[model samples]
Target: MNQVTNHTECSSLNNAKVAIIGAGVAGSTIALRFAELGINTTLIEKGPSLVNGPPICHLHAGGNLYREISDQQCLTLLQQSIDTVKVYPQCVNVRPTVVALPLTDKGEPQDLLPRLEMLRDKYKALVQQNPSNEVLGDPQHYFRLFERADLERIAQRELPKKALCDEDWLVAFAKQVNFDKLKFPLVLVQEYGLSAFRFAAIVSLAIERLPACTLQTNSRVIDISAKENGAGWQVTTAVNNDDRVNTAHYDYVINACGFKSGELDDMLKAKRQRMVEFKAAYVAHWPQCQGLWPEVVFYGDRGTPQGMAQLTPYPDGYFQLHGMTQAITLFEDGLVASCEQSAQPKLPARFIKKIDHHWPEQLVNDRTIGNIAHIAQFIPDFTQAITAAKPLFGAQQIPGDDPDLRAADVSFHESGYARAEIVKASSALAAADAILEDLLESGLVTSALSKRYLNEHYFPVSLQCQADEVTARAEQLAQERNYPIALANIF
Candidate 1:
């Protein structure tokens, strides 16, 4: 345990102590952010080291667009992602991403025009709102439209010889790449292909170096309970490989344990139901690409079982080819007992039974083969691409690794624990913001000073603007409707 720094005992903080369970990217980011605010923070991880856990390499900046999110929210998230790179440049690899639209029988790219135009309009609107926003330089420059001939030229120069010249291969590949489907192919610059392991390592290092923060590896939080007097929390942790149980008290607790957050939430009497789902994908690491292939995402057709296939290049001369299939839902009833039992000092029989019921150990090989076949459409070499073919969950212990886990679980319950989903590393920023806002309103810290700190250090320019706009819009809407405003309703 590291000695607490005197600076952490600031009057505004009222000698606040925060314990963040799980040292994944989300927890680590929050730990570092809180430490920077001169708060005494502790980051606990069940694993021996941060990088020893699950693999999460893909990172989306502005390139990977989602229809579900509002344009303003998307831009805000993108800016936060970019800001992450700015803060830790050495931990990421910035690269241009190419999203290939399907081609029609007439050899035209399908849906390219509408998609590109939509993006252009969206970018234009963002720039119109903030003329001086230079985070993403000129939107036109970054979002380039490439013609069929240009794409052919690029393929000829970059694709493998067999893929470039073979008529049969070309015909099969053409079905996947429709030049006539769209006016032109779209290219997005400033998107990053991150090394997840490296990013986690850097964050872990930063947390350890903070004088007011402590990094406790191999410490698994078994239970968290609110103090009887409601002043703080009592967190009980079971140290791995040691028959010992240690308990600590804190003013705040954040459950960034990724999948197992729901289990931790239960300990605090937070009864939110978290639905679990599993998607299997295999990653093939090729020694080298035939040509200068940047990160490529092949959009699946309507009938395709797999949703999409993404090829991400690493600086280490290897590409991670991923094929995402439709998710398999894990029934909520199946997980309740297991999740609850896992939080106890001793593991329950029902918990082990439940884990075996849902574990995908039998389908590992088949899932890997299926993923390889799906991705092989674009990269023919992917059919024979060298890969471990291990179940992704096999990379780390399953429900046993952390019992209360779920896929991309981010839920804020009445309990003090803020569960941050770790699917995208950038999710940490959102989680930290939520936690900070709660603290501000609780008067643990002065709102004005905290807001200044957030804006100056953590919040991106786009996010700041978006927050203000959302607030104003919500207020206006509330006045118009003669009702009180809620952030959720506004969004």
Candidate 2:
């Protein structure tokens, strides 16, 4: 294997190894893909667990939240979201989201109709191609409409003790929302919630059981160098509690560090353009609220005083809130871009400290309280809600300068190296497939293995990891992270 630059030189797929750095959503998904094909994979993570980088609450099935992104991006997101659910079905929470436009919003509620109809048609087509793709529900019932008159009828009725249908999900929300402040025909889309804790449980547990994969958490890659005349890569990693470093050889290395991706590029002596943004979501407790409620979004201008406000509900009356305004989620100088000298985006030191460890108690209280107040404007009763705990926060890497870019795929520059830089978690599988394609093109994988993988869509390895384990581990993770146990479960 010495001085082997060409991938074709490898005789056996079992012997050819891959090293992946930073086990976030993208890294974890890519590792799972390679391991399924019987390729030796080593997933190295700087953190103690995989997929722990950021808060992933919403499924973003239709990309309906962003009115700015192109319809093509929305369609791409819809397809990728279906792929994500097929692989990790336990992670999805079967809930609809109520999308509303406040009076202060610049766009009209009618403006959403065209895009919503398009999404419906696209979803129907996908389901027709393969019935399993109907993860969002029947395409005919993908969206439900509500007018001021409909709200009046539901607002006065008693909230259902046990929610069963879309009407039941709307009872609590209809009673709380301010009718005077919104436009006509509120749109309720079939977008769902994703439990990050359960997702982490599935990824970590599945990777451990795979004989071809070795998940090395708390091991940071210190250095990467060419092994003797640029044959392969020598990756040196520092174990968490060890004084000495351990090094390993690999035929290919993929860098999937979410926001710290540029640091890896710098190590490889490659200066590439990218942008990173730091964001967080607040958790609030509202015990007095009645019945199950759908996730709610009140659209407003981003980064302004009246930025968009999102309300997501968990079991046992725990609600997660996100205010796009600077006073809540956005921070001063929180967004940074790579320069010609360095590829790493330099965020404020305090943010880095919070990401490395945890946020200050006072800062957490301030942000969470501010978020409650923001939501209380629309849901007046939400003023009674109190701060839950530390906010779920992290940094995200965007491929280009467009701040609103929601879809990004893999980038391959070096012959033997690939960068899995996906903007959204839904894009994880797409990025992994892109990398797998590169391996096939380079003759690192055989046609037989590809055919074997093709038949196993909605993968079989995932079936071995049971939902009961996901439930227990998710509850444990929520408790250990200082969040309510109910946050880990679906409504």
Candidate 3:
């Protein structure tokens, strides 16, 4: 096929051979969609596409999990977000029971009933019904929306409760206002294993639909250039140990490489983007000495300098304590786990330090064999919950590689960063406040996000460890180990 410039020719892209980069959810799904329309599509992934293959560093699945956007125009974005989050379900631990804490005499902890009044008073809701609407509170509020009450009730009876302080022991029993696990769902668990499992499942949902997407592991996209005709783009990737260079051309390219997307923009001389990095870590724990309870328990910190840790269910038969502020061991199998010490879309160094210090000694390498086993052994119920959600099948194979290798390579260079996001008027992210607006219109999103249970109650507690302390301790550790450290926050 020759390079064509006619708008009429390209607009009818059906049956046109399409090339996509990064088989991660976005690229793979796009290829599948094109193939469904009878368009021949080739998906190019720089990593092994198989589920158990080499691990790839990807985006954190937060917005993907709890987003309330449901519009068709917003579906693509929502699907992509959910796909990313689902990849690490076990790690995104969801608490079945959210027990509110009340201060008692002698600094004891009291379990306050989970009430609708608490939701109403703590969370501001501009209830949307038909034509009526209002903005009652902020959107950062955190509330426990239960999806499976009966299951929770059963689990509550079986699980053991963890107290924040040694002085408290009287655990109260009450139902919290939450969505049915069969209906409105809360997926992010703040724990480790289940969160990871869930993330994987969501990614699988999108990948399974693509029958013609090819994933090439250990392939790094080194350069991307546009042709002189402006009809297409060329991407040069370095494959394997041979340093072999393979160039593939595409009529269009979607930049979904997360933090590294800036490099592609530079190579293509296209629009530039900015990304921050953060230092994120997770600590999974199970008691070394198994406790008597068969159910999972959750605890909240009444007085804390930073975010409080949550003790929740994990797979295999143990509990996991993890959060943004503080992480602790709850059961015999508990292990301190760090997902990664650095992340792109970086957080401030001081902020990272604050968060890291919250973990005392349970900081284990997240990918280590021992830590993985401990989580699997202790969190049995969590394991069952995650396994049930993951589909047994895998994605269909990518199409053949025979026809397009002879195409000429295109050359290009970086111009400058895009001052404004240049998107089609119909593009899903065209609006400046696309995320907020979509939720507002959907009725699912409300000022309730800024409520005490959601924001003040949940958000601050999550950030208890603060980024500042984590970095400070990390620096000290590096100094003691005689290892020079970079003081930058990696996202």
Candidate 4:
């Protein structure tokens, strides 16, 4: 087994070797944290690039999921995430936009208005009680309530005319849309549109620069087993496009591979009762969309095939439309049939045919057409705009990537192992904190040294310095190669 040692000022973790599987946001964040803590950390990724899967459209920093469940820890993590991202201003596009949720008039037993009102009241009281709290910033700036009049005023200038004419449309569908028993629609602030690939690239580049970090791209972990002596773990990996196999020993391993973690270890498989297949498509070259737009979430009416749709704009004049569907049984013969059955009325036959012909291995791409069709109902121009647009990327169903994953009970199979299935990017900070706490409690590292390491590396100065360095390197390479340094080229 190949063992690596860290030669840093923090000697407590100098001999500690850790391996993090996968290089998505969660995995990358954990690897960065460990690397910054002077541990001999290795980030293993199977893809050619670090961030190779479906694009992450936006970053929800204002406690969107936490506010729903009233989780105080989640809320604190959300704030830390926002602050961490702000340190890299050049890599991310931080925009102030209201996330508008249009209330539908479709008959449903549950009263959504009162629920929203109660939530608003709860947050309002929190703000009033602790005006100086960092997690719950100024409530007036963070939370907003948009009445019918405000919606109408914004619709006139923002929404297409055809959307207003269609009562069934999702956004600004009717002139007098009713929010039964409520004064108006609710909006959340501090939402930002992020270039997912760029953000990941920045972090990956920073990880590579760390003296204690080893980024092994194109390396797939084939097997991981406990050492014969029960002291650590022996990980066997197969390097892509190569016949040679390598083995490494690490004191700890973090499975941050999202849905793919199950493939590495049976114990890590998500025991989800039901799995919802979420799909999305990248639609680009929409001339109508000139600048940034709000991250819109159109709630689905009960009993309707419509579940939920998210429209997030990108800096490159492109947008992503995604949503969830009925549960699917993956790796089974009926997987395709189940996806087709759930994506009806929204997904067009042409789109489904495209997925069947091009990417049959994917279960979520089949729903891309349905998601686009659903979005077109509200934005009439969407249908026409899509004709000129092209499909850029997509991802299949991911278990444990849901908003509720954080609320689930956490259990570890091994003593020196941890799994960070952080579904939301904002939860990355909290996930790192949890892993460090576990390591300290498990006697893997000293508590005083761990705390000091965390305090020094939580918001590392290296990340802030890398922004300009990466930008300069990218621009230099673009100039040397005589190619454009646009977002598309760099990402």
Best by TM-score: 2
- Model 4: per-residue Cα lDDT over 363-398, one tens digit each: 443444555666665555555444223333422323
Over 5-103, each residue of candidate 3 has an lDDT whose tens digit, in order, gives 221222232333345555443343334333332234565656544222111222211211111222231333322223222222222332223332112
TM-score of each: 0.70, 0.95, 0.41, 0.71
Return the lDDT, model 2, position 122: 95
* Model 3: CA > 4 A from native: 1-13, 25-39, 50-195, 198-210, 271-273, 287-305, 308-312, 318-321, 325-491
Model 2 lDDT at residue 488: 85
The number of residue pairs in model 3 that clash at the backbone is: 119
1-491 per-residue lDDT for model 2 (tens digits): 22122123222354678888989889998888777666788999988787887799877887988998999999999999988888888999888999999999999999999999999999999999999898997799899899999988988888798766778888889888889989989998999888888888888787876667888888988888778766668999898878879989988899998899988888888777889999999999998988878999999998998999999989888988999999998887988998989888888898899998878889899999999999988999999999887898899999878888998879986777889888889899998888887777776676565644543443456546788898898888888888888888867
Candidate no. 3 TM-score:
0.41
Say what the RMSD of model 1 is: 12.8
How many clashing residue pairs, candidate 2? 0
lDDT of 2: 0.85
Residues 237-349 of candidate 1 have per-residue lDDT tens digits of 89888989999998777877655665685666665444333333344545543443456666553123544566665433344555644421121223332344344222234
TM-score of 2: 0.95
Task: Find the candidate with the highest lDDT and give its number.
Answer: 2
